[model samples]
Target chain A: MSLESGLNQNKYLNLSSSWRYLTVENFDKITDEELVKLILENQENFLFLVRRYEEKLTRYIRRISGLDKEDIEDLLQDIFIKVYQNLNDFDTSLKFSSWIYRIAHNHAISNFRKSKARPVTVSMDEETEIARRIASGIDVLKEVDQKLKKKVVIDVLKKMDKNYKEVLILKFLEEKDYNEISDILQKPVGTIGTLINRAKKQFKKIVEKEKIDF
Target chain B: MSDLSKNVLEEIKEHHITPKPKWEFLVRDYVIWAMFGILVLIGSIAFSALIFMITNHDWDIYRNLGQSFWQFLLLSLPYFWIVLVIAFSIFAWYDLKKTRAGYRYTFTKIGLANIGLSILLGTAFFYSGIGMKIENIFADNMPFYRVIHPGRGITVWENPDKGLLVGEVTGFIDDEGFNLRDLKNQDWIVSALNSVWPREVKSNIGMIVRIIGKQTGKDTFQAIEVRPWMVNCDRNGAPAVQPCRSLDRERKPFIPFPLIPMPAK
Candidate 1:
């Protein structure tokens, strides 16, 4: 079957020859699932998915691995390629963002394993947001200015265990809820709550142990 | 417009790819969950076997081990089953993490949940007889088990210095003493004037008891301490709450004699 006619007939993309007129603005109009369905028929449509996740995944990899831009790009390319290659296998039950993040998480971990170096903190631009989430009720980091507080958070995250660090990043930095974190990490919600609690405790302990400047 | 996006786009064009098939992911998910279920089952079975070992142990056999009741208990504990339960709990924790949402939970939470789930299932297994049957099968077949198995006349009783006796309270001699029948069906007279009772003592007829003291004669002993034979006092047999060693310390030595009412001196 012709690709355009097939997509139109299947109601997958709900578009046909008119797809040629699709613009960067129109890309955001379509859902990820719909895009995946469209891409299945016309491989060129994969660029839409690529555009959607590229920058987010890039930043995610950098925050988690502290890899250089070049390495992050290489990893991002690999992750996108992986996502494209596995699009047909994507479980519809999960949110598309979560599935993509899961892929990114797995790729970053495997990359870390091969390199055998611990992840370091390289940026704190999002410090204000992270600080707000992490220091929600705790007044320990409250008096510190945004920059120092961010520095403190980064230092503590760098020193903590990988599990604690990942949960902190996902919850506070990524702003993922318990259920979304659960889906991305593939663990039960109860366990996610437990990890976040433990992660907070570990973070506090590290901050106390290191005696970071206020 | 970024060069990296352009590069990724070119790469995509050069190598046409497709997502992995849906069935492969389905198979992977199901396989992980299947493994998790199996681990939970194994953990529960191990726990049930441990419960069976403790619940069904022959307390009367400690009298034959030629050791203090506490020593015999410490030695006969089901270490093998206990280790298996711990190992299986860890495995269950790992396996559960691999499930769709397994990574979100902390290690402590997963470990505790694993144990709690296994015990829940273990209870069913224990009640259904799988736990007891496995233990019986091991005792009946394995040679090593014979060494720890509690029964009548096991060679462990060859020594006569144990000084510990467990039996039924047949009669009350006085406030400081009682008549008893040891596990071996032998008769004995006990004097507990120098002993202490950590918990309340029931001298009701047919009540089982554990006595720690010196053998004063062929059928008599100077009781250093006395306790209810089994702790938690249920109709069905349960392990003793306090064995000899702890009870030995609980006993207050050199208390004033004539614990029973007596005529004025």
Candidate 2:
């Protein structure tokens, strides 16, 4: 059967009454390796795997999503579809989570490029102080309303380059390490470090230009 | 760092986009499949190796090959892998910089293929080298030795036992004498006394010692040479044994003797 037809047939089989009994509990006891084997044996059961990592996957997606809600959803859906199609080719030696995150990062960056958004530059000096203030839980936020402050940050991020934006989002929002971001971006650890440093600077510049009350 | 810039961090966290359900599902599925493939690949390799060893009565060949493979690996494996990764990264970076039209299509295909080929070749080379070492080197006589004492901290030749100092136990020397098993875990400190030693000394010791060949006695304590350990010095004035200073005055001083480079270096 054609690949598309095979997928449709598999999905139908998955939704059939016979498959309804295949619950999360059934696979919970199995090791990841064994669970994968089961999924390979029955492609229809792949949906369970989807449910398992949904929270983490969503968090990752959220980090790269732009300000536009619809665009974010569309990009996320596209990433998932790609993941579904590539399931059979997945390598099990690597952590299943990291591999998926890599895909998500790639997809998000690609979507960002297609949208052709202008690169945003935020001042490093200002952003660093802002970052410190946020980290220190100081009175900086007291001056500006929380919602308005958030809008300012989001607007500034939207204007930044996808590279900078992704790193900032992953680091600040998702709280991923430099190493994790490096893996996701497939960039060297050193390069990621430098990018993060520069990203913060650019972010600061943008924040200053906007003159959002800190 | 200013207070305003720091506030941006909190703002970013508060304004995180809500991930769509469909995308979340897709990401999860991809992860599962990727993990499955990797596990299968590793399992297949290990299984094949095991089967090959069991079927072949001549296990000696495998042993020798493994030794040679390990030697080469120790000498060059880390450097090789690092170079390969750096080279690939450079290529990827250049490709990305030169093209604006999403080189992902070509880049991913070529990059994956290159990586796959490199891994396959590396594994083949490793196994083949192991086989060669087993057949040639391992089959021959394997010299062993003992370490009388492991020096305190990083200090070389701190306490020397006055006695005959044998061939320096190279590679890894534990607190006890050089045992064959120690080779498994630690790299040895080369002997400082025997400058003429042929095979590489791979163990560390408290003092220089004259190896009287393998000790047959039951007692673990054996007497060996101690102080005034042969300190081999290079043109740079750095001693081969303990407390060797570098020719460049700016560089930090090192201990002389024992032929082992300082770990801090």
Candidate 3:
């Protein structure tokens, strides 16, 4: 499938009915206290809480390790299981989002360590190779299309340090606020600002070395 | 295409690289949400049950179950919040990853957010649990029981004219007799005469004997009644009876013995 088509599919699938509902509702209206009380009073509604934060959490994890969908899904499951098992101790004083995000961070770090120890083949490479083969077999005129150029862009991004890549994605793609970024990373606001600055500079340098334009 | 322009286009493309999922994204999200719902349900039921047990004090099955429940709640509450925080944080990280946000950006944001959330939530749960425990403790109405003396036996006495006094041995009370000189300045002797009896001993010794028509003054010491402070005498020693520690040193040394009815003069 074309890269455009693939992204379209992802967008369609990720923006499920539940997600749409969450996105439409202003999350600020529902206080953390209310959410916690709901969890305590009716556990079933806790799913809403999970859904509320899942996308952001998943995005955070994916950026850190560059793990594919399967690994990310498995890790996400493990994290929830842990949260489920220990929900009784959740302190109502804290923001519910912050608590869950902390869990995500630790689990991601641990998962990264494990992934480093037990290396897995990059499935994206395989997919790209297959795409290349398919494209080579197609009409010669179409083989040198813009789609192929996009693939090359993806390939270069894959080679960048995971840290630099994450900053770019969150800033340009996710459009998250600096405060939100700071909260997710457990860093001071100043530190996040600094990291973003450094990341942009490093990214620019990398592209320049590759003789690529801004 | 000019080399410079081509390079520029390539860089922009690289910067805009998007994530491609390997699985059906809808199904994954559904499964996660479903699982979360189930977990919350189970947790709520368990939490309610715990609250019920604590509030009702339905520990008839085992006499000590009530105490055990409080202990378990105290020990487990902190750990529960911590685990929840960690798990949710991981979930956030995974979400960030799937979106292909850069590692530094995603992790920094998610990590800080999660930690803050966990601490806030955990603290709230802990305080609530603690509050419940305090309420339970008071509700039990077990009586503020304390042992004034632990080991050597103490004899409680009441002089009707005075109030109440407890006497514990200095040196061992030999079969022959207690040596007055050796007992004079001993800690036990000094402590016993002065200290307030355990809270369990509500009535002064004089009152107990007075009801029996015991004479006051001379018969005061003999009229006094003494008992072990703790329920399980075999396990815990008698509570030490000492003057109120907060009192002035001179005042603390002498607990006025209650006057009993005087014997026929």
- The best candidate in terms of DockQ: 1
CAPRI quality level assigned to candidate 1 from its DockQ score: acceptable
CAPRI tier for the interface of model 2:
incorrect
Where is the poorest 10-residue window by lDDT in model 2 chain B? B145-154
Candidate-wise lDDT, in order: 0.70, 0.43, 0.41
TM per model?
0.62, 0.36, 0.32
Q: On residues B1-265, what C-alpha lDDT tens digit does candidate 3 reach at each position?
A: 2222233223324554222232455466566656544444333333432332333222221212223655644533433323434555566455544432224344667567545554454345433453233323332322221022111111212222233333322232323211111112322111122223333333221111111112333423322233322121121222322211111211222222224443564
lDDT of 3: 0.41
Which stretches of model 3 miss by more than 4 angstroms?
A1-33, A85-95, A117-149, B1-265
DockQ of 2: 0.02
* Candidate 1 lDDT by residue in tens digits, B1-265: 5666666667876775556678888899899888888988988988887887776455655654556888877877888788888898888788887776567667888788888899999988877767765765665555455454432222232222566666777887667777887646788887877687533454465666666667888888776667664334433333332221122221212223335555555
Candidate with the larger lDDT of 1 and 3 = 1
By DockQ, the better pick of 1 and 3 is 1
For residues A107-136, what per-residue lDDT tens digits would candidate 1 score against the true structure?
A: 888888888876776366655566567766
Relative to the real complex, the DockQ score for model 1 comes to 0.34
How far off is residue A139 in model 3, in Å? 38
